[model samples]
Target: MLHLMIAIPAFARMYNVSCKMCHVAFPKLNGFGQAFADNGYVFAGKQGEIYRNLGDDRARTFKELPLAVRFTHYVAASYDGGKAMTDFQSPWSVKFLLGGAPNERINFYAYVIFEKGLPPFFEDAWIDLHGFFGLPFSLTLGQFQISDLMFMRETRLTRSDFYIYKVGPYKITYHRGALLGTPIGDFGVVNGNGLSALNGKYYDDNPSKWFFGHLPLPADFGLFGLWGEDYDTLGNYVRLYRLGLDWRGVFESFYPFFQILVGFDNDTSNLFYGGFFGVDYAPGGDGVVSLLFNYVDAPANSPYRNERLATLALRYSHYVLTNLKVFAEGEGWLFKRSLALTLGVDFAF
Candidate 1:
């Protein structure tokens, strides 16, 4: 069954020659191994023809409200210390989505998720303001994933899949607020705040000589940091601060990826401290047979390291079908090391 699921998508991704040509139900999780193969081995993106209709041609044609919907479903089961199960059971999730560019300079996407046995909830809702201030900078405000040092993906090495276990507290939540992204020289700097008041900064209206490096591979090696405070209307609040190091060209090309993160949390009475380490291959833009690894050390030190959970994962994805996608993935955890292998197929339309 897994072989068949992947085979079809692998052929399709190779045939299309475009990754985003086939839209994914979950832009974050990507799809099954084979589905990726069918889409040319790339994650979903806005540049593909599948969403090319979102450009000016369609925007100008419609003057009223415009919308797009995305849906996703997953049924995965695994066996670690227990016997192998026959059917998909263990973990399952469904999601509803809507998004599109309603105007020439603005675009947005939202996702609401419904877990198998939890309360139906809204997962993410954020908007991007493009070409604002007549500069290359834009402000995104909403309750969405924090665009800090990590790329939100299950690929292990990307941000240390800290909260994969159902009961693990390592899972992160999207915070509410705004971010400022500007191109400083050839690099970029993105300053974000959790609360509205703290969004103010000296460079809000002006450009700086600073630079932002590429992901997986930041151009210049340096240290980055983040601090945030969340408050209610009455002034009661919670505060968190994080420090990260961005390393460049640190190892051989075979395993040329590395990053480190430390965080402190404060909530009036207590403080907590936590940290994570990630090491993987390069971006694998075209296709690199590589391995990705992540490990998170979380402690319950008052508010600084509030999560108090530990997680580790390893994953490998390849482009056997073409630049689109191909191959499969399997992940396990020490908590419930007996039953959780996710076999999926990825593809693009």
Candidate 2:
């Protein structure tokens, strides 16, 4: 059987509370948990305070800057009608989570990832402003995964075949020489030496240049060009700019969310747009069901054209020990024609 774990025991230590208070399962946030995040990870009453100094006249010192570590391991097997691949991955990944309130109105959250065959980097680093000019709006800044705004990827227990966070469409490029032959007028012929020349430029299947590098613009100019464009060695296109918005709210017993994003491809100057709308229905204890629809539209010249994905997931959990949980989840990706079933245990001390 496949196994998945979404536990975050660090937050439990920071609040000195039971894990069930915020999560129906390990990573799935309950209604109160959602409010805790929206409120800068602070509780509503005096019990949620983390700062030492209270008055405006005093310089406040943090009572605690909580840091927690999580280790995840799993074994997976997949069959696609041909050969089946089975592998055991233990201690597969690790994460360092840091989150807390610095002051009354500002909260910070950051996490670092340590995975096999990849350099360690900060996966998510963002600051949330509780209120802007006394309005209900908040501003988030830093390098963070934008998809978390609506879909809440972390809360999902099943491994995804297609990475949902990669919402942008990829640009497609064709070699100019391939177009020369046939009805398009031949500029050259395939020589016995496996080389051809076009317009006084020698073209080889392996050693020919198809694109040129454009100097990157300074960040201050508000336009950043690709650092290098070596299509053969590097990628063909670059992600230029992205703007997005996400909103989550509760109406009666349903938690609804909507998010949209627009991105530009630096190589083609084409636009890619995508969004998702979802609702979570949690009747009472230990079980929650959700339905989500996700869609992405690439530019006409993009390789994928348009890709869409939808998912339905269910999570159920219970505590056998004080901070230990037995949880299981089932999720299906409608478009991919795949289903993921997970059974895992979460231990938090």
Each prediction's TM-score against the native? 0.53, 0.57
In terms of lDDT, which candidate is strongest? 2
| Per-structure clash totals for the candidates | 44, 0
Tell me how far the alpha carbon of residue 296 in candidate 1 is from the true structure, in angstroms, after superposition: 3.3
- Judge candidate 1 at residue 324 and give its lDDT: 32
Task: Go through the candidates in order and give each one's C-alpha lDDT.
Answer: 0.40, 0.49
Worst 10 residues of 2 by lDDT: 177-186
Q: Could you give candidate 2's per-residue lDDT for residues 56-141 as a string of tens digits?
A: 54575566756767665545554434455555655566778777766666767777877764667675565656454665544454
Report clash pairs, candidate 2. Answer: none
Prediction 1 TM-score vs. true: 0.53
lDDT of 1 by residue, 1-349 (tens): 0000111222233234333333221122233433542232233542232333455665432232223222222345557566776455323444454444444356565656666668766656667665656667655556555423343432232212544221122223344545454453112223222222332554222221112232332474545555544442455554545555545343543434345655544533343334444544434353333333444454444432334444454444444443234333455455445434444333222
